[model samples]
Target: MTHKAIAFFDLDGTLLDDKSQVRPEIKVAMTQLKENNVLPVIATGRTEVEVAAIMKEANIDSDIIMNGAFIRVDGTVIFSDLYDKNLIEEVYSAARENNDAISFYNEKEIWCNEHNKFLLGAYNFIHTPVPPVNPDGYLTKPVNMLLILGQDNDNYYASKFPQLNFYRNTPFSLDTVKKTVSKGIAVKILQEKLGLTKVPSYAFGDGPNDLALFEACDIKIAMGNAVASLKEQADFITKKNTEGGIVHALKHFELI
Candidate 1:
């Protein structure tokens, strides 16, 4: 019997092009993977809405979004790790004091306290629309993640919210989640749920955040444009996303 495999991908700099578009070659490669019985799952820090727009262009659905804080397989949420109410309030207060914009994400929507130039710029960088603001609604329910845009005092935040972990996606932006949450945890859970433990699992990424993902998979692929540290740890290093790295890696491994 042949071993089944799943290809997990990080969105920015790994799967999506610089314009945030999924190129034609990538689409073809993904289709081939499915035809070959290999599943492709997107594991990223992107919100569902953000992922939805890209999926519309790329046409694949299984995803572990919000940096593994939320997991959706075929439009159904199989797992979610939400922030504690106290943690949310604490973070909200700190950002407010610093005049930094805070974006909150639930399974359904992405809301913000205020949309500043920095926040809007971050969204534009990813080609995502600016999220609506509902400051009061933030505390009303559990939030899956918080994106902080603007000045951040990392040490102060670390000491203040010791239970939460931060991933600096960009110098001006960072993501906060439960200290125990990660793409690795999501992948492990998804693999177990689907009984794919015996089969080899693969992950591709290009940043510091992808380190956990690298540690979780059987095959770790770092893109050519990936951070140097990530490339050092990769089992295989392929071309840049803009250069059709997905296709290159898939062909190199004979997944296609």
Candidate 2:
């Protein structure tokens, strides 16, 4: 289907509320968007499995997940940027040295090296249960993104691995992926693959990870509760997520 316009949405603090649930108005807005021939795609730092229920609830079948390590268009997996196994092992060893746990992610599942306070906090903040423990899970599966369960030291990993990108989306963990991967890159790829390069695009976000997403879109809409950096770059600043941010922005743009 050829969409008239495309909108990329960041989940936490943008589309989903504080409790990690989608508001009823947002769901209504999504249906209205589709009815208006506007494509709504989820662009989040989360994995496919992590957002499966929410996607179904909102009737969204496309996503740029794992901060852009993977892309699924219209319920079909079209792109994936998996991590190098050796590099993942090296990072895992380093995190172990610092007593930090690492979680491995693919399209379907997430597994961590160990369950600790940081790991628990990271998942708890997202309203999800801790992934099963598997010290060598990365080697066994095609890992798309890694979560470094640590509050600080994001720069430490960046300095050590110039080949990878680290985004501290939460205070409890860092989202790690290939340096070339980002929501922006994924958006561009999606546009090209779907032959929608000339279509108007909008990106909605509230956090540091969404910065790349904003850069890739034609119109950037940041939530009122968004980080100052994102708000400064937004073409339109909508109300807080819990305050009907998604609906407000859609209405403002006449997308719904």
Best candidate according to lDDT: 2
Off by over 4 Å in 1: 1-3
lDDT of 2 at 82: 85
Give a tens-digit lDDT track for model 1, residues 55-76. 7666677898888998877677
lDDT of 2 by residue, 62-155 (tens): 9999999999998788899888888888999889988899999998999988998999999999998789988876766899999999977777
TM-score of each: 0.95, 0.98
lDDT per model, in order? 0.86, 0.92
**Among all windows of ten consecutive residues in candidate 1, which has the lowest summed lDDT?**
52-61
Model 1: what TM-score? Answer: 0.95
